[model samples]
Target: MAQFYRLRVHHRQTGEIHDLTVASDRYILHQAEHQGYELPFSCRNGACTSCAVRIRSGEVFQPEAVGLSQELRDRGYALLCVSYARSDLEVETQDEDEVYELQFGRYFGGGRVRFGLPLEDD
Candidate 1:
């Protein structure tokens, strides 16, 4: 069965709000990337809380979140990059406040940098 995650994000800066629909099994970063949302993230793994946020409403699953202290977890802080939604959720994070869009081509070096010979061209 396919899974879906509904997210409501509140921007702390401009007080703007965004409703996002993410896949339940996929990392939140994928959703952010697909939607062109700027998330302050260094490590995409659960070791970093760069994507941390407070769960304003709903439930999420963190399978490998090590950086989240007990107090922080209790306080609703979570790493959005690693967490998967169990239900429709509302989150408040820094990303919404200072939204940034990530250019996919820049990081992957575009299609110019070849990994192997282009079979189609040959």
Candidate 2:
């Protein structure tokens, strides 16, 4: 039988709660996906820090880490895609609105152009 884990993610801005149940071996990103939560992430591996987040409570186990700084890990920051819950967890992170805005800035907004075409704007 597969073990079950409970997750409670708190959106820091709106104070919305996402309660989830996932297989013990499953990463938090999968749980977020199952719940239709648009979590910010890039590489599914621990290479990019885009999935970085702070744990408000409980603990997670990570067998491998390529991006997380030691200071962050000490302070409870984790890469959700490669971390497993060690207990019922409460995580705090920037809200969906901020993630959406970040996505827009990366894909469609002029933030990219401003950084790229300095001569055009100046």
For each candidate, give its TM-score against the true structure. Answer: 0.68, 0.69
Query: What value does the lDDT take at residue 84 in candidate 1?
Result: 82
Worst 10 residues of 1 by lDDT: 96-105
> lDDT by residue for model 2 over 67-107, one digit each (tens)?
66575688777878898888888887754344345434456
| Top TM-score prediction, candidate number | 2
After superposition, candidate 2 runs with Cα above 4 Å error = 13-15, 94-122
| Candidate 1 C-alpha lDDT tens digits along 1-122 | 64887888785645778788987887776687789776556677867656777788988888677766666677677778788888889988755222212212345545554667754554
What lDDT score is found at residue 104 in candidate 1?
Answer: 28
Error of 1 at 67 (Å): 1.0
Candidate that scores best on lDDT: 2
Regions of candidate 1 where Cα sits further than 4 Å from its true position:
13-15, 94-122
